[model samples]
Structures are given as structure tokens and as C-alpha cells.
Target chain A: MFPSRFDLVVAQTVAEAVEAKVDAGEGGRFLAGGQSLIPMMKMRVAFPETLIDINRIAGLDAIERSNGHLQVGALVRHADVVASDATFGAVAAAAPWVADPLVRNRGTMCGSVAHCDPEGDWNSVLLATGAEVIAQGPSGERSISIADFVDGAFTSTLGEDELVVGLRIPVPSGRSGGAYLKLERKIGDYATVAVASHLELDDSGAIAAAGLALTSVNPINTKVADAEALLVGQQPSEELFAEAAELAAAAAEPRDDVRGTAAWKRQVVRTYTKRGLAAAAQQAEGS
Target chain B: MEVNITINGSEHASDVEPRTLLVDHIRRTVGLTGTHVGCDTTSCGACTVLMDGTPVKACTVLAAQADGSEVTTVEGLKGADGLHPIQSAFTDDHGLQCGFCTPGMMLVGASLIAENPDPSDDEVRWAISGNLCRCTGYINIVKAIQTAAARVAESSNGS
Candidate 1:
């Protein structure tokens, strides 16, 4: 199926891309990986009048660790992340689970997060890690927290003329670990229920910081704030994790779909959250 | 807009619409039908091609997106000899039944072997997990890839 016709501007720089967006005036969309936008266009669900192609823009593909944050550029593909040495915490764990190998070759991490699909995996990882979205607009560059950046399903607080330049995921200063637990029907399928868990331990082996987020079981990538609150200051144990898992499952708003009944999915959420937290704790201890 | 794409080592420059897909460009404009289109929604790997030495779903990539990149399609998998090692391995091991998904599978296998000369069975399975085959169950396909890896290794060692 061919997409509806649109004018294409191959932006050579970020400034040019922003300018093009301003000219298109709400009808322009930046084409990063085109993995998500192209498919939506083919289905005629999205028909932007102008597309600012950012593939030619330079300096937007770096995956570097600097200033105590792992900065993933907008052009950083999922395959790049899996092969990079700079990833950590939930970012590294979830990179390989973003999609199948083929799709991962062309899909970008920032684009996936910008698409704001509740089923997308990277947002959950970013939410769980308390990452920031680096956005460049006509005014200037700014950093927005992941929690505030994601407005809803398939939506973000990013302005119309702004383009996401990168994602800043803070590097854990202490003993920390993370795991992305996903339940998919197949390799290329979206998660029926996925959990992203990150844990930091203090000197006394108590939970210092905790982040828990659920995917495919909520209106948006739901950060389990209540569950995270329960994890902090507590010693990692089966009982503690079980209570946190129960709270996480209670936060899910899964709908009955072909994957399974809503009740079954919520149960899966509970089980995965518990299991993911255990894996995180184990990794943290090992580290 | 004009896109100058290097396909199979030859430059095929053409003016295409902004919405034209890379798969359509390769199949229709370049006339290399070896790359089949299946489930154009990026679910199937029948449209897989090596864009700049990485396997990407062509149907999901716009022709304009691949403007300056080097693309290697199924038609490009050939050595100085009659057939590439992976192609011969597929023939020797009865890797294909209907051959609809053969091109995509071969491209992915060729890519996997290039990166890893001696991949384990699980690696081969994981490499081609994106490609789906309705027939032949996939045992023979995996065998073909492993056999190809061995043959390629033997040839390189002997040389």
C-alpha cells in the first residue's frame, strides 16, 4: 500500500529540520527511522503534508557516556544500542528486546520513545530509569523528564516545532541493576505484558532507589509510583517484592484482547514484576 | 525527488515519489523481483535487504530514506562462481520448499555468516527468527545455514 503523497525535505541540520517544521505548520513530521511513521502512513492513518527527513543529519547517532549520563542520540538504532558499550541499566537490558533483528536494524530509540505507543518498550525502560528527553526546537534545546514528556498513548508533550535530539539516561552512581521482562507471542510481536525494573542498593544492602514501570497494561507506559515507594528503604526480599508486585498489578489497566483476558494479563504483570525485581536485585548484588 | 541508490554494486538512480517504499523501488524500478513483498506492515521478513551491510525490512524503509546507501538484495548474493556458498548450501540441504521466503532467508543467513563465520545452532535460529516460512518447518533451513557456514569456513581456510 502506498502512502498518501507528501513533500519531503531532506534536512541537512537540526536547524533546517526545525525550520521546515515551522514552515509546514502542524502538517510536518520528522522522519527518523521511518519504521513507525512509514507503516502508519501506508495504513493512511497518518498523512502529514511535509516530511523533514533527518537521516542525513550528522552528529545525531552517538551513544556516549559523559557527565554521568548515557546520552543516546536521536539516530541511535536499536541494533546500535545492543552493540554499543555505553548502555546501562534498563536501556541495555531492553535494547535487545525492542524488536526482531531485522526491524531493530532501522528503528531508532528516540523515535520509538517519541511515538509514545504504550506498547513500545523503550519508554518503559526510560520511565523506569528516570531518563530525560532532549528536544531541540526553534527556541533552543531543553530536557524534559520522561514522566512529564509522555502525555498519553501515541502522544507526548513535545511541541509541534520541536524535534527530539536525544535521550539522557542517568548513570547509576552506586550498585544498581536493571532487567526488562517481556512476554511476547513471538520474536517480532509486541509485549502482551512487559515490566522494566531498576534497583539501587545502599551500603547496608538496602534499597536506595527503585523504579518500576509497566507496558501494554496501561493507557500509557505506567510508572508504578506506589510500588516504587514501597521498594525504597526496604531490604530486598521475597515478601517485599511480592507486595510491590501486587501494587504494580493493581496499577495495570489492561483490556481484554486476543493476547489474553485482562485478568490473565494482570496476573502476568504481577508475576513479571516480582520476577524482574528479583533479577535486578541479583544483578545489583553481583555488581 | 531523485535518489541515487547503489544496488548490487550498480548505481540505479531514479526519481521517485516521497512515499515510494524501498521494496517497491528494488522490485519495480530496478526490476529485481528476488525480494518478495509479504505482510508489508513490517511483520514479515520477506522484504528484507541489506542496507549498508545491515538487514532492514525494505517495505518499512522509504526509497528516499535509502537514497545514498548501498543496498544488497537477494539478486546480489553471488560469488565469482555460479552460486554463493549460502545458495549452494540451501540446494545441498533441501532448505526450501516453495521458495517464497528463500530470498529473505538467504540474505539474513548471508549477513549472519559474514558477521559470525561459525555461529551455533541457536544463533542461526535467532538470526532468521524474523523471517517466516509456511512450509519446511525450519529444520532444513537452519541446517542449510549451518552447512553454509562450515563450507565457507573450509573454503577460506583452504585458500
Candidate 2:
């Protein structure tokens, strides 16, 4: 099926792209990899009058490690994330779990974050890893915390004129490690329920810090603060992981869908969260 | 819109609609039909092609997006007189039953071998994870990829 008619505007720079978007008003959108947006267009779910192609724009794909953050440019593809040293914690680990190789070849992590789909691959990882989105508009640029960036299902705090330029992820330091684990119906399917856990261990092998978040279990991918708090100052143990998993399950607000029932998803999240924590904790110990 | 794309070894410039998918452009414009569109959605890798030497789903990419870029379809996988190593391996291992998914499977397999010359069976399966083979139960497909990896390494070493 062919998509609806639209004018394609290729922008050479971020400033030009933002201006074109502002000019096109609500009917305009900045096209990145177009993995998500193109599918929507093909389904006639979205019909933008103007698609500002930013692929030609330079400088948005640089992976830089500076200022205690890993700045991943918006154009940096998911495949690059896994192979890049700049990405740390769950974002890198979850890269392979993203749709599949074909999609990951072009789908950018910032595009995933910008899409803000409830079942998106990057949300749980970004939320748990405390990543921030860098949005650039006519006025300049601003950073929005991932927790605040993803407002709801398929929604973000991005202004119509603002384009996601990049993502600044806080560099996890010290005995810190993160992992993303997902349960899907098939190889390339979206998550039935996914968990991203970042754990930091103390010198005594006790947990010093933890960040837990789950995807597709709520209106938005959300952090399990209570579950994370439960792991703090506690030694890593199967019992501790089980308790945190239960708490994480209780924090989840899964709804029934084709994947499974709400209760079933909650249980899935429970077990996956436990496994994710164990992986992260083990990495922390080795680090 | 006028878009220029380098397909296989040829360069083509064509006027296309913004909505025209790359797979359509490759098949219709360049007349290369080896790339199949099993599912227009990104879920199926049937339309997978190498864009700038990386595997990307053609249905999700617009012809306009491939402007000034290089695309390699399964048509480019063969040698001058015989089948490509991956294609040969597929035929030898009986990797396909219907042949609808074979092109994609072979192209993805080639990509996998290009990236990792000696992929394990698990690595081969992971490489073709996006591609679906409804026929042959995927056992032969995995065997085909592994065999192709060996052939590719052998060819490279001989050269």
C-alpha cells in the first residue's frame, strides 16, 4: 500500500530542519531513520504534509563521552549503540532486543525515545539508566529527563517545533552495571513485558544503588522506585532479587492484550526483573 | 521527486513519489525483483537489502531515503558464472521449501558472514533472527548459513 502524498524537505542542518518543521506547523515532522514513522505512514495511521529529512544533516550521529555523560546523537543507529563504547548500562544491552537486525540497521535509539511508544525498546532502558533527551528548537536546546520526556503512550514532551537532537545518558560509574531483558511472543515482536535494571554494588558486595524500570506494563514505561529502594544497602541474593521482583510486579500496571493477561504479564515482569537484576549485579561484581 | 540510487553495480536516477518504498523502487524502477515483500511491515525481513552495506528492511525505507545511497539486493549476490557461496550453501543444504524467503535468508546470511566470518550455529541463527522461513522448519536454513560461513572463510583464505 502506498502512503499518502507528502512533500519531502531535505534539511542540511538542525537549524534548517527546525525552521522547516515550524513552518509546516502540525502537518510537519522531522524524519530520522523512519522505521517507526514509515510503518505508521504505510498503514495510513499518520499523514504528515511535510517530512523534513534530516539524514543529510551532519553532526547528529556523534557518540561522545564527556562531562560524565554519554551523548548519543539522534542519528546514531541502534546497531551502532551496541558496538559503541559511549553507550553504557541498559541502553547498549537492550539494543539487540530491539525489533531485529533489519530494523536496528536504521532505527536510531533517539528515534525510539522520541517515538515514546509504550512498548518501545529504549524506554525502559532509558528510564532505568536515567538518560536525558536533548531537544533542539528555534530558541536553542534543552534537556528533558527521560522520566519527564516520556509522558505517556506514544506521547512525549517534545514541542512540535523541537527535534530530538541527541540523548545524554548519565555514565554509570563504580561497581555499576545494567542489563535489559525482554519477553516477546517471537524473535522480532514487541515486548510482552520487559525489564531494565541498573545495579551498583558497594565494596562490601552490598547493593549501593539500583534502578528498575519496566516497559509495556503501563501507559508509559515507568521506574519501579519502590523496588529500586528495596535493593539499596542490601546484599545481592536470590531472596532479595525475588522480593524486589515482587515489588516491581506490584508497581507495574499491565493491561490485557494479545500478549497475555494483566496478571500473566505481571508475573512475567516479576521473573524477568529478577533475572535482569541478577545479570546487572553480576556485572557490577566483576567490574 | 527525483532520486538517484546506486543499485548493485548500476546507478539509477528516477522520479518517484515520496511514498514509494525502496523495495518498490528497486523492483519497479531498477527491475530487480529478487527482493521480495512478504510483509510490508518492518516485522518481516523479506524485503531486507543492504543499504550502504548494512542490512535494512526495504519496505520501511522510502525510495526518497535511498537517494544518493548504495543498495545491494540479492541480485548482486552471485558471481559471474555461478551461485554465490551463501546461495550455493542454501541449495546444497535445502535451506528453503517455497523459495519465497530464500532471497532474504541468503542476503542476511551473506551479511552475517561478512560481519563475522566464523559464526557459530547460535550466531548464524541470531544473524538471521529477523528473517522468517515458514518452510523447511529452519533447521536446514541454519545449516545453510553455517555452511556458507565455512565456505566464505575458505574462499577468503584461498584468495
List the DockQ of the predictions in order.
Answer: 0.89, 0.85
Interface RMSD of each: 0.8, 0.9
Output per-candidate TM-scores for chain A, rounded to 2 decimals.
Answer: 0.99, 0.96
Q: Over 4 Å off in model 2, which ranges?
A: none
Write candidate 2's Cα lDDT for A1-287 as tens digits.
66799999999999999999999999998899999999999899989999999999998888889998988998999888878877766877898899887788898888889999999878888888778999999999999999899988889989889999998888866788899989999888989999999998888989988889998998888899998888999999999999999999998988888899999999999899889999998888888
Query: Model 1 over residues A1-287: C-alpha lDDT tens digits?
Result: 98999999999999999999999998899999888999999999999999999989999999999999999999999999999999877778998888899989898999999999999999999999999999999999999999999999999999999999999999999999999999999898999999999999999999999999999998899999999999999999999999999999999989999899999999999999999999999999888
Prediction 1 global C-alpha lDDT: 0.94
Best by lDDT: 1
Docking class of 1: high
Model 2: how far is B142 from its true place, Å?
A: 1.8
